[model samples]
Target: MMRYILVGILALMVLAVGLLSFEWYRGQNQAVAFGAPFELVDDSGQPITEKAFQGRPTALFFGFTHCPDVCPTTLFEMEGWLDELGEEGEDLQAFFITVDPERDTPEVMKTYLGNFSDRVTGITGDPEKVAAMAKAFRIYSRKVELEDGDYTMDHTASVMLLDRNGDFFGTISYEENAETAVAKLRRLINEG
Candidate 1:
């Protein structure tokens, strides 16, 4: 009987240790917040920081105003998603960060973003600052020279979804299905 009790106690101790180890491993592996600190300017030339990404859920897109298709299309769809969500998404905020800061000044961003939802704010700044911000967010952008001595940017076309706490949540790919995209936004607002 004593032997059985000792074995039982040993089993219980092993199980306890296993459970604790699992919890500890999970805590270690869980993501530590998202995004790096940044100092940039909004369309109105206001100093904006990573703090803008907090306090409310954020939909952040990285693209250049000169993008021929993806940028405008994504912005239009983002506006629609916001409109579709309506009051439900009142707590949500959207941002457009320029990857081509050399050509996209604050004034230019203001004019370019005018065609999108007023809820969407444009972010641009010094080229180096913008590049650093893009790198921190894992956004890829490169300039491609055209035959006419002009240039265009090749950039990531996904919109990053961040929770109110500014943690990485998910993304909305360019030209994502409207229903699926709206559903993702709704989920972000409702759960994030």
Candidate 2:
């Protein structure tokens, strides 16, 4: 009876693995999608919104200029993927929206993003506006005080993708390969 029970458990485990593998292979549930809207200030200080993304698919990342690792790393990876995409990249817009608006003024955003891909544009605004924008995008962010009285932002590190119509597209994982991102962008370009 113990042997039979073990066999049953083994069979269930195999079935579970098979189902999960199939789901992964089918490429379903790859991202949490949102068609949310936002209003913030552009690098040039113009008021911006989803209207800016109407004609092209966009990748949006939320963080602050103070992030030491994940923020820059993700921006670099996105840059690499865009480089690999060539012209297809031209049809896409990339945004770096700041959660720490107090310190991420338009000028500060410009200088910070200049260190990364020029293809990306940075946006910031008042604290309330920033909070509303983050909420609209379903982004979670908060300020954390370090031991030295300095502060850093803790935020969701996911890259959000939106289609040309400013509709919910799919999200690209931080660990996703450049090829995957390129393929998704190509699909969006073709579909756009």
Query: lDDT value for candidate 1?
Result: 0.92
Residue 93 lDDT (model 2) = 89
- Candidate 1 lDDT tens digits, 50-164: 9999988899999988989999999999999988988998999999999999889989999999988788899999899899889888899999999999999999999999988
The prediction achieving the highest TM-score against the true structure is 1
Off by over 4 Å in 2: 1-37
What lDDT score belongs to each candidate, Candidate 1 first?
0.92, 0.84
Give residue 24's error in model 2 in angstroms.
Answer: 25
lDDT of 1 at 166: 85
On the 0 to 100 scale, the lDDT of residue 164 in model 2 is: 81
Kindly report which residue pairs in candidate 2 clash with one another: none
